[model samples]
Target: MQKQAKYIFLITFLIAGLVSQAQVKQDTLKREVEVTKAYTPTISDANKLNSMPEIDEEEADKPTFNYNIKSQPVFSTFSVTPLKAATIETTPPIQKGYGLVRAGLGTYYKPYGEIFFNNLNSKNTVFGIHAMHLSSFGDVKLKGGDKVDAPFMNNEVELFLKHTIQQSILSVDLTLNHDAFNYYGYPEDPVPAPLLEDEQSINYFGTKQAFTKGGVHIDLDDPGAEMDEEEFGFQLDYYYFGTKTEQRENFANLTFNMRRPLTSGVGLLDAGVEFAQVSNITLPADTAIGKTSSTILFAKPAWYIGDEKANVTLGLNAWFILQTDEETQAKLAPRINANWAPVEEILKIYAGIDGAFQHNHYSKIAYENPFVKPDHHLKNSMQQFRLYGGFDGKMSKRTTYKISGEYAINTDKPLYFMNENYYFDAAYNPAPLIVDNTFDVMYDDMNRLKLNAEILYASSKKMDLSLSVNYYSYKMDKQEEAWNLPTWDATLALGYKVTEQLSVSADIYLIGDRKALIIEESGSLIPEDLPIRKSFTLDPAFDLNLKGNYQLTNKFSVFAQLNNFGFQQYERWFGYPVQSFNALAGISYAF
Candidate 1:
């Protein structure tokens, strides 16, 4: 009963509180709520980890590497063992000498001498002096069996000095020459009363002709120079010529050469200028014939193509002349050339068209033909043109050959003819001696053709042989024949070395003669109409010569020469025959 009474009271109180809360919820009111702290949830780990295991690459597997070694250049002193050691040999140097002297005498009363003095093995300067003398005291028989003293004396002296300035060279040369000859030529057969035994001797009436010449040359060669520039070189030449008579001449010349390179030395531009002046033409005899001087200006400009194996040049050569004796003239010619070598050092072929001019100075005429008289101012010859082709080279190790042909046309070609003159000097006691014994020069136009062949054989065994032959054809314009010019010529030379100090040589010459003229005065001493010039053939000339040399010591040697073995009295010029079977012996010494 007491619990029931407590519950009933509690129930009554709860019911009353619930009724009040319901009334508060049904009423509208404003309320605010605030929180000051943040809440974080926490997790606690167990003993086991959550990650899975991975393979241990360092413990179970290893990496593989591949590499290679390369070779390189290394310098070191390393030697191999030789099987047998011997001495190393070297080649010996050649010996050089300073001075040389040679003297000889021939059976025809001929004496020859030569001497040379020079410096040896000089580094800066080279100097030399050379002197030569050749003289003959002999007589030559005329075509009519008449004898006359045909003596000749030749003397020459040369001095040269060469100095090196850097890569270029400077050279100075001086030359002196003197020659004397006697006029001994006579007409063929028909006897002249003036030269007969009854009359005075002709030798006493005649005088020896003496000619003297002096010359000097100066040159400076410098290959390194600029292109398009004028003065690349300095060259000078001068000469003075005098004769026994009143005739004299002076000549001087200057030359300049220029070059320009294109295409590295394969192609080049070349040019040259030459001014040659011949003056002082004097001599009372030739004065009235117009003693005029010759002045010439020559120029050549060419283009060079190709290289050492094959080459060609194309250009022109021109000339301007001022001749006081004739009209002034200008000339031109093609200077075209071609060369090819099909096999190097084996065969070479060449072809060219060229031209040239030669002065007919007394100095040259006397050298070629000593019988010339100095009473004229002759004209210079002009080579209009020339066409030539040839092939030359070694055929085998011991043999070489050359074959060539040439065709040329020239104007004012000098022809030698027999002098035909009549002079009577009663005041000098003259009975009209045979004065037509000399030679005179004449000018003419002519055409010439030539074919030549040559063979040379040589070996290291010290044996050599040379054979050559030439044939010529000529057609004269104003003259009947090519006077005294040969139509064919041949030569054979052989040499052998029997031992180290002994050697022998042999030579043979064959020459075909041309036309010659013989003039004779038949009737009057001085006639109005002169005899006509006629042409007659001379006999062929031949000569055979042998020579020997023995080297006795280091600086001494002996030589002997035998000429004209057949004693053949061959006639090389009109009314002049060579010595028969001459012999010469000499000794040479080098100091």
Candidate 2:
């Protein structure tokens, strides 16, 4: 078998080399012809100028004329329009289309086990599979995990379609996901213990609870016990816009666009309304534990005042949201933005007051409590308002800067993870502890402040650099409970155009330390101190392209490409690795 495989590989390599050579020869011939034609000259004046003569004072002094009629070659009397290159009749290439198919197989390694399992160790040799298809119509992507004990099966499928009409456009999207895979404990193993004291204990044998100290032994014979959860959804959008042109006007827009140009040098006018709906189906522990559906309707009308060099936008928005089996919340939001362009093309400044209200059933304790009676009940509503302002613009041809700040207010009862009843003392007071879930007029509001800044600089041909910093702090009514959370992220990208056909790039990302502080209500001397954890990661990548045409005949040619080099590991989330490095070189024959 090994000998046979070697022979096959050799044959494939030879074929690819032959094809590449042929393509290069054809491309050379074509380029040579283009160069020669570009330098070729017309012969119309050669004979006429020669016949007109060399030392005649009258001819030298007077304007030269082509008196040699034969040299003119009897030019056509009828006028002729040059034939254009047929315009190619190319489509927009389908903004979201697909034309290529990619598939790769690789190895993955990661540390895994129970969250706090002592046997946690890194596992290698995990297989990885990736498949992608892109075309002018749509795209498809598929990936799978390689090893056992992986978090989930990691499957996702999405579809998108767009259609255009005379003055309207429509888009549709669909997605399906199934990402629930975890370890199942054995009968002799201890049941998983609750992370929180008030949480109920679960049996170890059941797939729902994988870890526990002690529990009644239950048979793990159920077939559905190990099944993973599934979720899916779909979305659609339709947009329509029309325009009317007027003399001297800069531009006119008719749509749900909030900004419109004016005939005068003044700023623009903006107004629009947006509606969105989402439905999620969740099955936890093989049971329909949670499901949420919501619809939101909102509209914003804004105006840009002042000249183009300086302007301000004042807008108002109102939102109403309704959740199935949950509460209905409403909000009125407002925004203000200012823009200053000191140097029309070089520098600009911007600032704004962007505020919004968020209301949802999950903000209430009744909806958060999993063990509550009539699980879907309206209990309380939490409202959050944010005021933000920012400025972003170019500092030079290759540098840009952005700075922003935000202040937020969170009102109503504290947002707790578990149901409210679980936190109450059922033994001391049984009658379903009832308390108004309202923000205390005196001191129940939560205040948060955040400041952020980013800078990007690019060199003429080789390097791109970026840096950013974020600072956040929360001030609640309780002083000791208040905490500060700050995060800093930075990245640098460098690309070298080694040659006309080969290029390479290096990218690095850094994340600063992040700490989460939580105060538990334990009837003890003081709250237990939990250790803060930090994580770091690094990744890098490269690409190569060899493009040309190979002539099979005078009327036929083949084009090929050698793409994606080094196949480095790229990941956006922890524990989830992306496709491995692989080469995709294919040839297409054109006639």
Off by over 4 Å in 2: 1-98, 109-148, 163-170, 177-295, 321-330, 359-387, 412-445, 458-461, 478-485, 517-591
316-435: candidate 1 lDDT, tens digit per residue: 776667766456566768899999999987889999999987667666665566665555446678989999999988777656778999999999888777744444556445545354
Model 2 over residues 1-591: C-alpha lDDT tens digits? 565445445434533432332211100011011111111111111111111212221111111222211100111111111111100101111221112222222122211110000111212111111122211111111122222122223333444332222212233334333222222211111222331123333211112211111111111011111111111111223322111110010111122221223343222222223332221222223435444445554444454557667877776555555555545555555667788888774667776666564433321222122111222222223335677777776776666667888787766433221111112444434333221111111124567777777665544333334555556566776533321122344433333434322333333333333222222233334457442222223232122222223333322223322222334333222222223332222222111
What TM-score quantifies how close candidate 1 is to the native fold? 0.75
**Superposition TM-score, candidate 2 onto the true structure:** 0.44
Question: Runs in model 1 with CA error above 4 Å?
Answer: 1-94, 190-193, 196-206, 222-234, 263-290, 421-435, 519-530
The 10-residue segment of model 1 with minimum total lDDT is 67-76
C-alpha positional error of residue 84 in candidate 1 after TM-score superposition, expressed in Å: 49
Compared with the true structure, all predictions reach lDDT values of: 0.60, 0.31
